[model samples]
Target chain A: MVHALGEIHRVLASGGVLIDLRPLCDRWSIEVFSARETRHTGHITDLPPGLEDDTAANRAMHQAEINGWFIREKEAFFPLHYVWDTASDMEKWIDEEWVDFVGLDEETRRATRSTWALGDADSRVRVKVKMLLTRYRAIK
Target chain B: MSARKDPEGNETKHLHQFADFAGKRVLEIGCGEGRLTWRYASASALTVGLDPDKNALRVARIDRPSDLADKVHFINSHAETIPFHKETFDIALLAWSL
Candidate 1:
């Protein structure tokens, strides 16, 4: 990851900007909602590898700043929500894409399905992820 | 299953505030399927989206806007080794791929 950061610095023009945007290594708050109401299921924590990688990413960025490759700047947090029409659809998508990083435990699955059953066709499943968006200015 | 992401456009709005994509050369790393590339690629002079996932790159190429044929490109590569000379891009965006 540090090598990637250095390569980013190498390829950027003087005074150019490097945007570091990613999800924080924390619990993902899962929610089931419909047109009229919403319910919050328990959060899902990231797997060991995902947690380790994000921690390393932070260290790499700090090293980049200390090396004077880029100057750290403003950063803010935002919620990035992924919504699916049904709980099963959400399960399938996550199983396919994020299975290695996150898992839908039996308890959470039950909660999601229960909350979803309360609504009509309007019910939707959501995974709300906290994202960290920050920028760095390349050093000349 | 169909999935809708970021319905509020918060990511786009924040991106616009943080970096002006207008007429700039942009490098987007880990640009999975270009789902986020289209958000700002329209405003950029040139965009090169790099990712190691060939399937995702193929999808990105197929789904790219017709008008951006010349402005946007997808590459199968790794972020550790950007395939370009020094000082090649005005902005490098690492979105969830670091």
Candidate 2:
């Protein structure tokens, strides 16, 4: 990953910007929401292989800065929502795509569905993804 | 089991806070299916979206907007060994791939 950062440094013009955006290796909040309100359902932890991947990515970015390839400029945290049309839809998707690390066991599934039931017809269940959006300046 | 991501447009909005895309050359690394690439490509003078996944690249090509046909291009490559000359882009965005 550090190698990739170095390559990015190489391709960018002098003082060009490098933007790194990715999900944080932490728990995601499951919620039921509409335009008016949001209710927290449960938290789903980002698990093993994926957690390790993101952690390594964080370390690599720090290493790249340490190497003086790029100067850290600014960063922000934002909530990225992955919305599902229905509670079951989210469960099914998680079973296939995120089962490796996302902990959506029977209890979490129940909690999410319970919250989904309390919302209006327009309500949807979503995973609130925590994201780190950082920009750096290439030190050419 | 399809899910809509970033319906609030926060990703693009937050990205805009970091840099201005208007008329600049941009490179998006690991631009899977060109999801984020399409969000900001129209503002760029030139945008290149590259990924090692050929299947994803194929999808990105298929999904690319018609107007961006001249403005954006997809490359089948990896970030570790980017196939480009030095100082090729004004901004390199590692969108959810770093």
Candidate 3:
């Protein structure tokens, strides 16, 4: 990643800017679950359970490393939501769009399905993902 | 311009505030299927969309708009090794590439 940043810096013209929008490695900020059996629940918090502190630490390390070559201009956070019309849509997204999130064991998959199950097969499901946005200038 | 709605699309508004490519040369890395090339190509003098995925590039080429045929070009290449001279482009957009 550092090398790629360096290459980008090298390729940019003087004073050229680099906009980076990446997922925050920290714990998710929100989780919403809705089902026919249970009432809709929207869990919004500063951090989610089972998230290790090391994830944020690693992200900071990466940002600092990039700052060594590029000048930090701005940073912000935003929520990106994905809405699936059906369970199959969600499954396909997890399998295709999000390759890294796939390949879980059957038990884990079942647990995830239960967690995100909707009112019916055609019901809507939404997942809110938090992202970090940073703008940097290539140091000439 | 309503930031409250379509927050993901609002990111582009922020990016535009930081960089404007009117009449400038632009290079986009990992430009999958030229999803964004059509958006900014009209404002740029030359826009090169590069990606390592041949299949995506093939689709991009086939979908190239006739009006943008002269302004937009697609290249099959990786971001690590951009096939262009140093300082060749006035702007380099990664736009969700990273």
TM-scores of all models?
0.94, 0.95, 0.70
Q: Which digits, one per residue and each the tens of the lDDT, describe model 1 over residues A38-58?
A: 889877757888788888889
> Candidate 2 chain A: worst 10 consecutive residues by lDDT?
A97-106
lDDT of 2 at A80: 92
CA-only RMSD, every prediction: 1.5, 1.5, 6.4
**Candidate 1 to native Cα RMSD, angstroms:** 1.5
The TM-score that candidate 3 achieves is: 0.70
DockQ of each: 0.79, 0.90, 0.30
The positional error of residue A88 in candidate 1, measured at the CA in angstroms, is: 1.9
**Cα deviation of B71, candidate 2, in Å:** 2.3
Off by over 4 Å in 3: A25-68, A102-123, B1-8
Better of 1 and 3 by lDDT: 1
Badly placed stretches (over 4 Å) of model 2 are A35-37
Model 3 residue A44 lDDT score = 23
Residue-by-residue lDDT tens digits, candidate 3, A1-140: 44555666677788776666555433232222344443233332233322333354336436745576567777777766566554345556655655442222354345445655644544454445566567676667
DockQ score of candidate 3?
Answer: 0.30
DockQ of 2: 0.90
lDDT of 2 by residue, A1-140 (tens): 99999999999999999999998857888988888888888888667987888889889989999999989989899999999989999999888888876767678888888878877889899998999999999998
